[model samples]
Target: MKVIAFGASTSSSSINKALATYTANLIEGADVQVLDIANYNVPMFSEDTEKEIGQAEGAQAFLRDLSEADAFVISFAEHNGHYPAAYKNLFDWATRIDRSVFGEKPAVYLATSPGPGGAQTVLGAAVGSAPYFGGNVKASVSVPSFYENFDLDTGKVKNEEIASQLKEAVSALN
Candidate 1:
């Protein structure tokens, strides 16, 4: 099976990114593609832009990636208890190009943060919106107090209980 993984945040040191990458690595015998949304550089979605220029090069490339993936792993990073601006922008543009970007693909939705909430608010919103984009959420996990619960450099879960829970959740996707 093929799996594509990415975090919703653009930050270079994103804990959510680490969590997604770690989860992707856990899947056995699966081809993995890691995406950085910052690399896409999509402009904010607007009907005017779409009518005039059509989809941007970045959006088209991202759409192609989505089309190629058999499964998706997304780790959301909360900003003000909601989705980050950059990720939301890319998602908006992708949906405009194809409202169902996920195309009924199975997805593992994850979230991580330094605080106790662990981006759960954004994760909840994503879970609600995922179906609209053709995503079938197979599993979801929230990694709270990420820095305390995980080792950043090694991508190891420090809390065994949380680790087991996350493993179980990702296993469901497989």
Candidate 2:
């Protein structure tokens, strides 16, 4: 299966990216594409901007990514209890291209943060929005204090419980 995994953050040193990358690797026999939101940079989503440029390169790229994927794995990085600006912008651009970019494709939604809440609010918001945008909603997980649970060098889960949960989420995707 062709799977596309990405962190919603555009930060170069995003722990969310690490988590998504690690999760993508756990799924066997899948062609995984680890995408960085930075690759698709837009001026920012706005009616004024859209009226001027129609759609930017980034918006088109977002649509292309969805069009090519059989399944999606996204680990959202919360910024103040909500989606990151970069990701939200991408979502805006995607909706402009196709109202339902997800196209009811199965996905493993994830979230992570430095605190114990593990970006739960943002994950919940996305989960609620998923069905509206054609997400199959296969599984979900939240990794709290990602730095504590993941080993950067080995790219393995240090917390056994979280690792097991991650495995179960991935298995559900199949």
RMSD of each: 1.0, 0.9
Look at candidate 2 and give me any clashing residue pairs. Answer: 104-134
Candidate that would win on TM-score: 2
Determine the backbone clash count of candidate 1. 0
Residues 1-174 of candidate 1 have per-residue lDDT tens digits of: 899999989999888889999888788888989999889977677889878788887888888998998898899999998899998888888888899988898899999899998889999999998999998999999988998999977778889998888778778877
* Residue-by-residue lDDT tens digits, candidate 2, 10-110: 99998888899899888999999999989998888888989999978888888887779888889999999999888898888888888887988889999
Give the lDDT of residue 151 in candidate 2.
Answer: 96
Please state the error at residue 32 of candidate 1 in Å.
1.3
Among all windows of 10 consecutive residues in model 2, the one with the lowest summed lDDT is: 58-67
